[model samples]
Target chain A: MNQNYSTVAQRSSSVLATNKVLRNTYLLLSLTLLFSGLTAGLSMFLNMPPMTYLISVISGMVIAMFVLPRFANSTAGIGIVFLITGLLGFGLGPMLTMYASLPNGGNIITLSLGGTGVIFMGLSAYALATRKDFSFLGGFLMVGFLLVLIAALANIFLQIPAMSLAISSVVILIMSGFILYDTSRIIHGGETNYVLATIGLYMTIFNIFISLLQILGIMGNDD
Target chain B: MDWMQIASALALGMFLIILFPAALQMMKNSPKAAPSDWKAVIVPMIIIVLFIMLLIKLV
Candidate 1:
């Protein structure tokens, strides 16, 4: 009886821990999204030059990869999350403006935003409800990500619109896989830190949104 | 070339440098997958593709 009781207690505690992480991650993600949106709006209002985006985004990635992880365990991580996300959003400002300039730009943006929301919600719900281990995707997705990055970098010189569309489509698939992997990790206790979890999800959503925009823009021929 | 093109190439190149080695290491360490795993990934992807196609058609 004691052995059985101990097992039950351990499982219960694991479940509780998972719940806490999942709850905190979603809460932080929502707040950060709102924060980023505001910064993007400010950037758009200022009409920052196009180059502002590339520089800010590169800086954000560098910080997120190198600096944020160090502070991820402390309260300072929250502030850093905001800083990184704000920089990314601000970078998006000029891109959004360019899209909005297209004849059907407004519609394209709205549709992309909606599509991203739907995909994220759908995938998250599936992973949470099923509680499957998607850790297996890590290798495959990482390899695909590298391959796509190589393609994208090469295409910078090529500058082919069709290739851009292909890259965007592949990116969407990769991001979708990440959503499932990240959500599953939260449920299975693979990820314990809500801060890191929040960053992972936020970046996935950010990638999905941007990829959708590129895909939609190309499909709409807003060149 | 325009400044924007130069900036993009530089940024993308840096991103590749930062992400490449890490990704390769992760891939090296990741576990081998079962068929069910691939199915899990593929089904959802197909749905996503169809959903995207629908969205494109709507556009």
Candidate 2:
């Protein structure tokens, strides 16, 4: 009887802890997204020229890979996450402006945003509801991510429009996969740090939105 | 399609072919939680399809 009571107590406490992590992750994710949006808006308002892709990508990687992990356990982690996201948002200003200048650019942007929202919400909801352990995706996701990165960098130099479109399409799928994997990780207690989880989710959403916009832009030009 | 288009399609197809099997295997092997109502999953998928269609129409 005593063993049964202790077991029940342990299970309840674990559930509570999982719930807390989920709540905190979502709360932080929302705030970071809003913060990123504000910065993006500010960049647009200022009409800032787009930072060079090499510089922006390199700096962003440094912050995410090095700075984030180093400071993820401290109060400073929140600030670093904001900085990384805000910089990314700021970098998007020029691209947004370029798109807005195009005919039907507004519609394209709106559609991309809508698509991204639907994908993220749907995939995340499925993961949370099913509570499937997606940690198995870790290796495959990493390999796929690296391949996409290499392809993207090559396309940057090759300047092949078709390849660019293909990369965008592939990235859209990968990012969607990431949304599922990351959310499942959070729910299954594979990821305990809400800050890091929030960053992961935020980056996935950002990439999906951008990839959709790129695809729309390419197709629009063809039309 | 042009050569570039053909190449692009091939690349995308290859990646998807490799990825799909691995993902399915992972899903099969992973320990699943208590099954939730299928409705929850189906509803979101429908929404996603509709949303994609909307984007295609816009493009």
Candidate closest to the true structure, highest DockQ: 1
Q: Weakest 10 consecutive residues, lDDT, candidate 1 chain B?
A: B1-10
**What proportion of true contacts does candidate 2 retain?**
0.14
CAPRI docking class of candidate 2: incorrect
B1-31: candidate 2 lDDT, tens digit per residue: 4454444445445445555665566556655
Residue clash pairs of candidate 2? none
Q: State the lDDT of candidate 2 residue by residue for A54-127, as single tens digits.
A: 34444665688667988888889988888888878777777888899888899888888888887888798778
> Lowest lDDT 10-mer window, candidate 1 chain A?
A214-223
Task: Compose the digit string of candidate 1's lDDT tens values, residues A200-220.
Answer: 999999999999998888888
> Which candidate leads in lDDT?
1
Model 1, residue pairs in steric clash:
none
Candidate 2: regions farther than 4 A off: A52-54, B1-53
